[model samples]
Target: MREVAFITQNKEKWLNFEQAIFHRRFKDPDELATLYIHIINDLSYAQTYYPKSRVIAYLNQLAAKAFQSIYRTRRQDTNRLLYFFRTEVPLTVYQHRRYFAYAFTLFFIFVAIGVVSAAHDDTFVRLILGDGYVNMTLDNIKNGDPVAVYKSGSNWGSFIGITLNNIYVSMRAFVYGIFGGLGTGWILLQNGIMLGAFQYMFHAEGVLWESVRGIWIHGAMEIFSIVVTGAAGFILGAGILFPKTYSRKTSFKMAFKDGIRILLSTIPFFIAAGFLEGFVTRYAGVMPDMAALIIILGTLGFISYYYLIYPFIIHRKTVNSL
Candidate 1:
């Protein structure tokens, strides 16, 4: 990015800030403060890249004027929980959205490896899924219900067990980032391979459709949450790998906090996934096709919207709100 290009790109925003500050175009300090943060960021960039640039003085002037307006009308925000989900997560996720793409790309590659391996090798699925589980599923398939495994436990018992396991898996993805995200990638590889192998086994047995409704009744959100948490893990690792302007220790602390918040955001979705797996998936084999499809699509849509699409929407709204 050349200095001229940078100035050209940000000129409109700078002009907006200038008008807001000099002409009293914005009385709301919250909005002005938000604009101030943008100006300060640009000032920092100008100072770093072009130490003697005239743009720094202009940005500094805008920042200094906005500072007084901020404190004069600043009000404490009371709805911490609401803000965390509604504003904080969206902004943070948007900032690191590329990590999600990385995680998902890895997920697809690993899953494809699993599928190809299982397709070519008769025993590869068993190697990944283990003999006992494979044999049990085969037995269920023979009995005309390929997914009868879901019916083994009481609903509440299964829900509690599955939810705990999900939370544990999510935290593992986050904690493993201490190892520079390789640990999280390893976890994703293992799980992705297993999922691919599991699905292919049913396809090879001519029960792919039977498995789809039952498995995806909950797997939609469950799988999405895992990938998301894995992205959080990468975010955690990135702080250590590329600390940029901050010290490594400070970066680690910041990434850890942000990663934990991202992990926390997945809990409700995990619980919902667990509830579906325990209570709904067990009946998917017997439920009406329309009903099963609705649940599957609904869960998938809701989770996908939140993690994939909503972040950008919120980000655009926040930036354009100025």
Candidate 2:
């Protein structure tokens, strides 16, 4: 592609990205993600497709300037949340897959920790879960209803509480990026170990599959939200660790902004997960087999669609456009 042609082809997208970043009251996640993808693609194309061209150098400079502009002033409004969901969240998921090795290593470490601790001492549950929560859960278990903790509160109240709590957890996960992302990894490790230990306890009680079917209805989304949160933290931390051409502060600021944007996108997912856990999870025994299956499958579908399918579609569309 010639310089003028390439510039013309992307002119509309660039303009939209600029206006969305500056003029619009709120930026759309879809638009913002699209812009991000475009800028990266432009740079990649310039470096690979026309490395020696003066146009390549000029475009690189242009992209750098544009990135700086957006970095300086992050316009957040109502559309901010919407754009985050449509673009930011999906991209985070996609980006995290590149670190599947890290995630798997963490998973194995947490699982081993749970197994080793459980095998060595019966009090491992207390270590994994706080003493107070463990005692409360044990009491609940002894009361002839192990899952009674999920049975409290009306549906609406539970929905609000769970959603808010989950979002708070996610935001905290992102905030931990300030520690150069080690804090983020700790959050993931802690959560993963708790999950492993919690499930192991259920297994000891001879209700592993039952708990899986019931709890995972919401956990699928809830856990995925955490993974995305961790990914966002990693992005921030990665920027801090490897600033490339930008100054440490500039890169860190940009990463933090993008990370939070990704975090913002997951609010609805957390709310839905909370609702499922609070309302639907309580009625696992009463919920029809088909309905339960549908909910579980639906949650999986949402995750797969956003994380895997949508990213592929967007990548192909952008590449084909160029």
Candidate 3:
């Protein structure tokens, strides 16, 4: 690229970085690091092609300033928790939003397959959910309470156990990314199929709406968190599979960090789901329909906004600001 053309093309971006640094406008470390990476790439290009030009010197100085700024700001944030939820996670989500879509698509497809299979074969639900569970649920349904299984456990014990199990499942989903994402896909498929078949069982028993009111009260957040964790796994797998301009190690490291951040973001939601399952779901039978709808739709809307809509809004705002 010609020096003049290069400068012209990137002048606005460079100026935005300058303004951000000088005015202390950067909102997060990730944003600053992103700008620093772009500046360093430009610096490398300038040094290679404009060896004798003033642009090389200019880029070097700019790069130095960015490095110093990033370094100086690199301290343990006292509000690390707040900053992570407010900025870091959202930005990371925005950057890898496509992976979220991929995960959801894979899960939905698996769910459809499960529904169709269960519809055709009476034994399919039992196979996926295990014969023991299927028998227990059948007993519960015959006893006039299909979701009575949820009500059997002590509330606090159930909360603690469910929370731990959810965290474990999420961690498993994330760690399985080491198998090049196939493991993550398997996890999603298993869970999605189980869910579809479970719902179908209720439908077959003529209690589909009753099951929805009870199950989805907590399942909304629980299922969505699982899907998000799957996306995290794919993010890590993609780093190993397609390193792009980065070396495999570097790409994997970056992916691992981002994936961990994304995975961490789901923890709170998992806990909430657990709480709902332990405390609220037990009362699903007696709870007013409006109350159940509020919990179910509210959880769905919140997760959808944060994971899906808010990320896009944040990305657009960041771009516009730049």
Worst 10 residues of 1 by lDDT: 67-76
Instruction: Please report the candidate that would top lDDT against the real structure.
Output: 3
TM-score of 3: 0.79
User: Rank by lDDT, descending?
Assistant: 3, 1, 2
- Which residue pairs collide in model 3, if any? none
Q: Rate the local accuracy (lDDT) of all candidates.
A: 0.85, 0.70, 0.85
lDDT of 3 by residue, 86-155 (tens): 6677777876778899999999999998999999999899889899999999999999888999997799
State the lDDT of candidate 2 residue by residue for 61-101, as single tens digits. Answer: 33433443342344344585565555455544444455434
All models, RMSD in angstroms: 7.0, 7.5, 7.6
TM-scores for the candidates = 0.81, 0.71, 0.79
Q: Please write out the lDDT profile of model 1 over residues 121-238, one tens digit for every residue.
A: 9999999999999999999999999999999989999999999999999999888988999999998999899999999999999999889989999999999899999999998999
By TM-score, the best candidate is: 1
Global CA lDDT computed for model 3: 0.85
Regarding TM-score, does 1 or 2 come out ahead? 1
Q: Roughly what TM-score does model 2 have, to 2 decimal places?
A: 0.71
